[model samples]
Structures are given as structure tokens and as C-alpha cells.
Target: MASRAGLPVATAHRLTGELVSWGALQRSGQDYLIGHRIWQLGLLAPAHQGFAELAAPYMQDVLFVTQNVVNLFILDNDQVLLLERMSGTRVGAPIPARR
Candidate 1:
């Protein structure tokens, strides 16, 4: 991982330890995964908070009318991320967004 990231092994190890202590990473068996704290912080971003507030009413309307599922998405580089998801039905599979 360090070599792939172009960092020395020792430096990567130290930085990884720091991130773990800072609640940014969590040990998962032999690997590290994003921690809940990082997710929480991401939600605190102004863009995300504003978009969520702005989309709330529309999301509710979709649920009220369709009685299916409503998902909010935003473009990130070349991919779309599911910013918010409100499900009115439980049976359908997830569909990827494009743009």
C-alpha cells in the first residue's frame, strides 16, 4: 500500500497510525477501512448539508406520489454518488447513475 501510494513503508505506517487515532481509519482484519467519523464529517460539509436541505421537500413528494424509491445523486468527477436515499418500497435493486 505504501509503495503504491509512493510513500516509504515507515512513513506510511506512522501516518496510518495517526489517521486511526484521529478516527479517519479503522483496522479491518488485514486492511483499513473508512471510519464512521470520516463519514460523519463528510456530511458536515456545506455542499452536502445544503443539498440535503434543498432536496428534502422534493424527496418527500416523490415518495408520496410514486410509493417506490427515491434517491438523490450528485456528480463527482466522472461518477455519480448517491448523496441521499429514501426508500418507499423495499423490493427493487439499486441502479447506478450516469452523466
Candidate 2:
């Protein structure tokens, strides 16, 4: 995305460092990804994960009644981290474990 945005490599690197310092980004090997601290902070925000956790039981009840899937998502910045995701499913998703 930075490349697409025409961001200079040096500027991108410096920006990434700032984000990491703020706990908004995590650095792994040579790449950057969402930091766990962000998730920890989300748990503290009343309007976000805090409320979601509180209402989860009710939401689960409704999903059970309707036989539907329940999904929860947390938003984060756009940075790919060096990590591996292993699953039974096979797809062409990019794997950054080699970073």
C-alpha cells in the first residue's frame, strides 16, 4: 500500500517506527504488523471491545436461535507482519513467514 501510495522508502520506514513506538504497529523481522498492545487497549475502550464482550452472550443467543455464524472483528492499520498462518484450507494467501 505504501508503494501504491507513492511513499518514499525512507519516509515509510520512519513512519513505521513512529507507529511502532505508539503501539499501533509491531515490528517482526523486517516487516511491520498490528501490535498486540492495540488489542489490549481495545479491551479498555468502553465503546469498542469492552461493550462487545459485554454483549457477546446476547449476540450468541440470537445467533443460536437463527442458526447463523457469529463473527467478531477488530480493525487495525495496514501493515503486513512476518508471520505464518497454518490451516486445513488451502488458498493463495500471501505468507510472510520468510521475512
Candidate 3:
């Protein structure tokens, strides 16, 4: 959205703060993105995680075959947590397992 609007960094920061305070966005580290409240409200409609868990094996097989990055994400309060990720290179990136 900032990229589309061509907003300067200060303006973006201010706008993001407003949104976050209003429960529309979440500030995590230096990244301003979506918040957990939205995810919880959406999940209440169909129990999204349970269905995703059941399908994870099939997804993992495809990801393994392709040797590509696979990520499963979850929201925790103001933070977006990575539940799972499959990567071949262990040293180049700063991942939770490596850390």
C-alpha cells in the first residue's frame, strides 16, 4: 500500500501507527503488516487451522519435490509467527531453527 501510494517513510510510519492503534494493522519489529484480530475473526467462520493441518502432508510432499520454500504462518497477538518452513540451505539465512 505504501509502494502504491508513493508515501514517504515518515508518513507511512504515522499512518501505520494509526492503523495499528485502531486494530487494523500490527507492528512487528520494523515491519508494519496485518494484525491477529483479523485472523481470529476470519478463522471463527470455518476452523481454518485444523483443515490446513490435515492437508499439510500433501503440501509438504509437493514442496519437497520442488525444493522450494514452504511457509505456514499463524498470528499471535501483534506478531505473525511462522509455524513451519522447509528450506535446504541452513547457513545463509537467519531462521528460527538456525538461531
Candidate 4:
């Protein structure tokens, strides 16, 4: 990790320990993975803000017309991320859904 990051071994170890203490990284067996705090922070960044709200209406419309699953995906870098899914209608839908 130090070589990859171009930082000294001791510096990398100190930074890694601090990040783990701050809930930014977690150890699983022998490997470390991103923790919940990092994921929450990513959601607060500008690129992810309000995307679910802005797409909710369209997702609901698709669900209303097709009565099927509606998934909203965003292409981030090379990964396709599922931002939202509309699978069920409100408790009191105006019209009955098809069988």
C-alpha cells in the first residue's frame, strides 16, 4: 500500500491506523475494505446529491404504467450503481393492478 501510494511505510501505517479508528476502513480476514463512513460521505458529494429525488417521479411513472420493478442506475466511472428501486405501490392505489 505504501509503494502504491508513494508514501513511506511508517507514514502509510500511521494513516491506515487513523483511518481504521475513524471508521473509514475495516479489516475482513486479511484484507481491508471501505467502511460505512466512506460510503455515507460519497453520498453527500455533489455528484450523488438529489439524484434519487430527481429520478423518483420517472421511476414511479414507469411502475404505475408497467406495474413492474423500476431501477435507477448511474454510470460512475466503470461501474453501474443502483441508486433507487420502485417495486411496490402506495397502500391505496387508485386503480387495481393486473393479475
Candidate 5:
């Protein structure tokens, strides 16, 4: 991580420790993760929520009728984004998000 960030190893270690202390990040074995604090802050802005809200009622109807997982995707340039998903009561297969 230090190499990727172009910071000295010791400096990166100290900074990462501080971030963890402040709940901005969490340590998961050898990996660092964005913590609950960051996720909570992000919920405040809620980018792309307008379209999602408009589609939500229809999505709910579809879920009610099909009783299956429904996902919404939008093509942005070369990438396709999963903007919304509605799954029935059961937990289906996991679909992880990627950048």
C-alpha cells in the first residue's frame, strides 16, 4: 500500500493506524477496509438516488410478481453499472460490486 501511495512504509503504517483509530478504516487481516463511519457519511449525499427512487415502485412490483432477484444496470461509457437491485425474501447468489 505504501508503495502504491508513494509514501515511506513507516509513514503509511502510522497513517493507517491513525485512520483505524478514527474509525475511517478497519483492519481485516492484512487488508484495510473502509469502515462503517465512511459508509454512514456517504449515505448523506446519496448520489444517483433520484432515478433509483423513481424505479423503486416498479422494481418492487416486479419483485412481488416474479419473486426473484431483479437488478438495474446502466451503461456509462465503457462500463455498465448496477444501479439498483431488488431481491425477494430469500438471499440469492452473491454479486459483489467492482470499481
Candidate 6:
């Protein structure tokens, strides 16, 4: 981790310990994974709420017309995060997004 971050080993270890103590990282074996606190904080961003609200009506319209499942997602940290899902019995298979 220190080498990857371009920091001294001791400094990296110290920073990792502080982050773990602060609920920002969880030590998993020899690796660190982002903690639940980080996810909670990310979800609290205003953009999430604003985007959900802005997309809600369009999402509803599509759902009403097709009666298919709808997923509201945002790209974050190179991953897609599902923010909302509306579904009925007629849901279809997933479609991959294009770049």
C-alpha cells in the first residue's frame, strides 16, 4: 500500500491505522476494504438526492408505460451504484450500458 501510494512505509501504516480507527477502513486479513461508514457518507451526498428527484418522474413514466423494472443508478468510483428500483411483475432482463 505504501509503495502504491508513493509514501514511506511507516507513514502509510500510520495513516491506515488512523483510517481504520476512524471507521473509514476495515482490515480484511492483510487488505483494507472501504468501511460501511464510507458508503453511508457517499450516499449522503447532495448529488444523490438531487439526481434521484430529477430522475424520478422520467423513471415513473417509463415504469407506467412498460410496467417493467426500473433501476436508478449512478457511476461512482468506477462502479455502478443502484439508488432506486421500481418493479412490477413484467420485469425484463438486464441491459448493459454503453460507454
- Which candidate wins on TM-score? 4
Q: Give the per-residue lDDT of model 4 (tens digit) for 23-83.
A: 9999788788888799888877876548988888888888878666788899979988777
What TM-score does structure 6 among the candidates reach? 0.66
Higher-scoring candidate on lDDT, 3 or 6: 6
Q: RMSD per prediction, one decimal?
A: 5.8, 12.2, 10.5, 5.0, 7.7, 5.3
Q: Rank the candidates by lDDT, best first.
A: 6, 1, 4, 5, 3, 2
Alpha carbon deviation, residue 4, candidate 1 (Å): 5.8
**How high is the CA lDDT of each candidate model?**
0.84, 0.60, 0.68, 0.81, 0.81, 0.87
- Candidate 4 TM-score over all chains jointly: 0.66
What is the overall TM-score of model 5 with all chains considered together? 0.63
**Separate clash counts for every candidate:** 0, 0, 0, 0, 0, 0
Clashes of 3: 0
Off by over 4 Å in 1: 1-6, 77-81, 87-99
| TM-scores for candidates 1 onward, in order | 0.64, 0.41, 0.35, 0.66, 0.63, 0.66
Could you tell me the lDDT of residue 24 within candidate 5? 90
Q: Rank the candidates by TM-score, best first.
A: 4, 6, 1, 5, 2, 3
Worst 10 residues of 4 by lDDT: 88-97
Off-target runs (Cα >4 Å) in candidate 4 are 66-69, 89-99
Q: Write the per-residue lDDT of candidate 2 for residues 1-95, one digit (tens) a residue.
A: 36966898888878878889998898889777778787677556656646566667766664554444444444448742221122222244333
Give the residue spans of candidate 6 off by over 4 A.
65-69, 87-99
Model 3 lDDT, residue 77, Cα: 92
Q: After superposition, how far is residue 59 of candidate 3 from its true place, in Å?
A: 15
Residue-level lDDT tens digits of model 5 in 1-99: 899999999999999999899999999998999887876675565665876888899999878766678887778799776678887764564444557
